[model samples]
Target: MKSLIQIFLVSALLTTCINVNAMTASPQSWWVGMQTNSLQIMLHKQNVAKHQWQLMPYSGVNLHNIIKTDNPNYAFLNLEISPSAKPGTLVFNSAAGGRFEYSLNARKANSSKRRGFDSSDTLYLINPDRFANGDSTNDSVKGMLEAANPIERGGRHGGDIQGVIDALPYLQKLGVTQLWLTPPLENNMPSYSYHGYAITDFYKIDSRMGSNALYRELAAKAKQHGIGLVMDLVLNHFGSEHVWMKDKPTADWINFNGDFANGKHATSHARQTIQDPHASDFDKRQFSDGWFVATMPDLNQRQPLLANYLIQNAIWWIEYADLSGIRVDTYSYSDKAFLANWTKAIMTEYPQFNIVGEEWTSNPAIASYWQAGKVNNDGYTSSLPSVMDFSLQESLIQALNEDESWNTGWVKVYQSIANDFLYPNPDNLLVFADNHDMSRVYTQLKQDLAKTKMAMTLLLTTRGIAQMYYGTEVLLDNTGSNDHGDIRIDFPGGFKGQKSNAFTGQGLTIDQRDMLQTISTLLNFRKQSAALSQGKLTHFSPKDGVYSYARTSEKQTVLVFLNKHAEMKSWPLHYMEEVLGSQIHATELFTQQTVNLNKAVTLPAMSAVVLVIE
Candidate 1:
């Protein structure tokens, strides 16, 4: 009888341990004083809905309700945390005798008022997997689907948060004020996961990249170097292998009943349909509801529970990581209504925070509709503060590669910038020469060093936030193909057996060294130039292959001239008299030569000239 009793007790204890271990929460914890009082926590486990839950009495905390879904594995708890609630733990018990603890932590001082990246900041976009490998031990973590294969372009290269932390001083010296790393969230896909678009777990960082604590440490160390961190977030879709895919909370958790139908439900990429007044309902649905690929399942943000989960998840990360900004990938592919709510919630909590959305369109009309304060004719409003300047990006490429003409060349760039009026706040736009999705600027310019210099000069001197792809300063190029893997090539000296070291400036050709120096000079100068950072822009029409513009402010005036001629030209400055006023002499930014602005300025062949008048 005693032996049988011991066996029964051991079985009961094993069952209890399994139950406790299986239980999980989306946001495992909360803060004491947020802007909002109500919080919804999603709990997941085996047969979680079958058990009745009761919260242990805690001061100023009330269990408003428990919502059970169609699936027995999921339960949602709606709680009201009052302002007077203090930081403590709340214990909950189920009728089946299962218990779990949730924590309510105190908020950091002035957490909600943290400043975000702005036009004055230059963002350096890094592919963490290709930047450097500081912790090779975590490179091929056990149980991870993919391992480090540095030789394979598409395979993981083992770069982690520590690598970025190691290179903070190099980035600071490179004149980068902000670092925009590609989505470092967990991507457990079998292949092609290095890009980080297909996120499997939203709350957890990829072990191959680093832990959540290490990510926060990167943010802290970056701050010490005067660089803010910008997290790249994917809201449109997630990896098909996400846990929710196997056990959905709601029937509509994944779009199309979680069925791809073998490309039958692929997105039409009709982004303009969002703003098109006459777009068909079928087209709108196909564009917004369709999946990017079979491996990437489109999320149904219309589901209230999922919506709440995503919003709270974003807020939780912002608080946890002390982030400075967020870059939303494939911004318009998500449900339009949910997008409005999502952006509004984030902005409400952090009024000074900035979020840039990638609309990926050259038409400012469509992109402008998503910016906050846009007065849409269809009565739609967005809380998005910034949009990528794709029009200028395309036009700048054309302006550099094509010959000057009445309807071509520099005119394209001029017309592109002229459309800035459509934007509510043009200065908030993100200007970049090349991003990870496209060919490097040097390759696009056909390895023309002079033209590449002109492109960088215009991007940095323009009236917007600037972002440079990693290794652009060293003229990293993909000459043969535009493969994404090639575009995101590994940085020199980040891994073993590389002859060049960008950090130490070893094995770099003369041209590479010059390009690095030129970009460094322009970026550092931009940091100190009020006229370039946030000022009024007055531009002259393309004349004799020269595109001239002047950025003026209360402190000083900056004149920029992009001369495409093969020989030095004396460009007349009479057209800029209104902005120049009584200033006669100016200092050249690059050569530091004093120039007389009374008549004309001498511009170098196929080069950019920036002159400052005080």
Candidate 2:
């Protein structure tokens, strides 16, 4: 009897241990990790049915453990499944409880071959809703922001990841090295949110644009075609309807939620406070925590969990998609300390990675302070490598619009480059004519094709990195209003039922085709020119409305001349006599004609030429 009692006691103890282990396990938890050319997944305590435990076998499921640990409660399972994984729910049986289910989605591993920023690449920025709509099936998603009319400038015409993928060849042929699309993260809001500025879920891609799998495919395919992908990241705020807003993670997760905290007025002076240790906390909060727009709720990165989550999400995308770079929106609006840490961490993993912040300040000092090498008075450091040269943009617009004058006018462009001394490396700055926010460049230049070509020439041949707004090559216009919807117009023929398609080379006006061909030729020429890629830039502004520069190295030389004034201008060869050093032969890049270097050259009004000295 005593022996029987001992056996029963031992059996009871063993049963209790098993039950404890089963109860502690997370039955609903599922995770993915990267493996060699695949992903490995581990499902914890998968409960398929009541009182029965079964493992559903899956073939072609590659699995790897990112965090291999004995601690069952906190282990991360990574796996790579076949790219053709069926769209279905994952159901499994739990040993101690009921069944569990999770959605299985295809995710691609990051590419290992490509890394870092390239100098020769030109980025084309596009607002997806305004770009193209390849699929109409998901145009009006349930419980999503209502679709607006495509003709009604502000309406959301469904432009998904697939649309971009389909248009890749068109962009590539135009000499675009990188494609920067607006944030495609989930922004399930109530109204007027087509811009994708207000993000709700950091981890999930907007379903309306297609699933996260499609996004990864876009990135991979883009790289294969020699086009890099630049993701637009938002760290300042999220839509008020975000899930976290309903459930406060901590008491101080947000600022002034109970009362209206109207944001500070736009000021270039505020950047001075970012590096000042003596700056007031109120000013700092206003700069970092203030709302960008009323509908978007500001995020407080001081909260540890929120900061960590954001940092991890960024890294996950970079590693998962093998992104070439990230274009951070409203970059200065985030906490300075957090921005520094965020950039530092990302740079540590990907040293050659390129990150361009949107400072949007017209002052060189303010913009330069945020760049990687500016030595702030207070010793505050930022790891950001590049900033959008808003200062140059401001000068360029003014120069293009005003009449020629001795002190100002077209000379403002020359004056703008003089401010290049303010930047540690002006070559690293990102120069652009216009983006999605402002008026289109062609519209700003009053729809003059000659002037448009002149601006394009200046942008491409300038010292800094160049980024072209999408549709600029085709002279797409939004002249009547500055509304975002007006600026982001649909690309003709990107949709299925459209009368014309830019990709098929149909429905384009003669002018549009000419512009496209011109841009393509220039891009292809730049691709093979070593001088344009890494040579030092030297400019000669002998007179107003005439600017000439040479990008030269030991073996190659590229000379660019811009004549903005009407009629022909005679430039004496003696002005560039120094540049003619020991070189008697020069070929016009655009016309392919050899020109005499000993005499004056007649340049047509508003004409630009790129000459390769051989």
Candidate 3:
């Protein structure tokens, strides 16, 4: 081990080097909201903690406190801004350094009143690096650690915010009301910068992706087209290469002793065990404190300062970009109490906004525990409004692929929905057939066009916010491999001179075109149907290779039938009196053909049929 004199000498050298440079402050811009009174500005400079900071007497802003840390490179300045403070720059000076100015801007009109995505919205998830390269010039931005490489699956492909802007029209026409892009923040990693999950600079967008202004522009443009933007955020950990790794402000800024190579600090992937009543302290610590990956250093939210920093970081993004929602990655991996507080803080600010946590579990019991209003035995409460419906996704695949049985196939789909009692509000769940990390839904059903369409139909008509992975409409599949790099294939038309263009519908197979049309029909119809958006669901038990469900709103009712039988089969309607009571007529939503509800409804073999009560 190094001696005390050696450690002090090293620290002194760093402190001296940073001292020669000017002081830096975070949150270059601040929005003064109704409840956003005090703002914490973190100052970064060598030996910054050694000097006291004071704010000049200003009209509407006052110095609350200056919080210094163990590291000499950082200090926190808490400034309370009164309502009278107009949009201008607030200056703070330190005897140790010079002036640090932070601009305050008036929030946009009706910002707090902005609505988050819900069941009424269809989320279209896209990987930016694989979407499209709008500007080739930005493909290889100078100084960025990574270079653009289309042939490299895990490398950056130059897809930026401008590419997303160009696709807004296409996405809107496809009937998606919300666009969820993977993280666009700066990830200056040596490799795998395309993923954007390993955030190096939270305040700035990845240079390769575009500037922060462009990201805000994407949100603005999307909003103009009646589309909301959902930003993917990570609260569990950040890229290990983050600048903080060089000069940490506090000893516990990161978990695992700030060392991922340590075998003792490796993650145990024991998330569900967090809710176990008999779980040991060791197991609980391992789940919450371990590093996410060697390149990602787990954060210690138990530290109140770090917790507030993260909470403010999320709020900063929402306010900066006018975001409609946030999808938290690896929700259950962070400290449980910190997660609770984080959600509460966001909800308190944006009561109408929505935040969906990525709890990738096949068990409804565990996923439900993360939703708001869950009365856990351990007294755990979550302010999270929505969670990804991994259970339903898995069940949908099984329901279509496996044969019907007592506890398998169609029964799997039925029983999963029956577990809705576990969630505080099942309609708020984000349901999807597959996402970036999973095998494409088309591949999951063995590339059977009929099964793929049926799955899409079910998800569109089901009782939650439906999300479709990019290229799913065109049957993008990776065969049977679970490799994430392959699972997220580039959209056929994203690049120039591609084999086929999804945007222009060029060079596509008959099967692909048919699947695309099938999904387009269902999504467009669902967009106009309140019954499929915000409605009550009633499903019956599977019977004779047939499963049925209904979504009914005030005056609109939608009935979905899934038939796996070999030949055309008709199911009696007399038992469906609750939904079809006294209704003698129905309209086939897909074909727009009228039919009699009093007689048995005929279902095609291995197909999904939708009808509206008339």
Task: Estimate, for each residue in 1-614, the C-alpha lDDT of model 3 and write its tens digit.
Answer: 65433432442211111233455566656776557687887878778787777777778899899898888889888888888888766666668665555567788898888899989889999999888878778999878888887887787777888888999888888888999999989998989888888999877788788877788889999988889999999988998788789888799899877987755787899887799988999989888888867888888999988888888889888888899999999999999999999999999889999999998898999999999999998999899999999999999998898988888889998988999999999999999999988899999999899899889998999999999998988999899577777887788888876899989899999999988888888888888888998789999999999889989888888899989888899888777789876778889977889978878999999888899874
User: Which segments of model 3 are wrong by more than 4 Å?
Assistant: 1-22
By TM-score, the best candidate is: 1
lDDT of each: 0.90, 0.70, 0.85
Clashing pairs in 3: none
- Our tally of clashes for model 2 stands at 20
Candidate 1 residue spans exceeding 4 A from truth: 1-19
**Candidate 1 C-alpha lDDT tens digits along 1-614:** 33422432432211122245557676857888999899998888888888788889999899999999899999999999999999887878887887777778888999999999999999999999999998989999888888888888789888878999999989889899999999999999999889999999998889899888789889999999999999999888999888988999889899999999999999999999999999999999999999999999999999999999989989988988899999999999999999999999999999999999999999989889999999999999899889899989999999999999999999999999999889999999999999999999999999999999999999999888999999999999899987888888989978878999998899999999999999999988888889988789888899999999999999889999999999999888888889998999999999999999987789989999999987
lDDT, model 1: 0.90
Cα lDDT tens digits for candidate 2, 511-612:
888777777777777666677767788887637677788888778888887777887888766767667687777888778889777667768788887878
Candidate 2 lDDT: 0.70
User: Of the pair 1 and 2, which is ahead by lDDT?
Assistant: 1
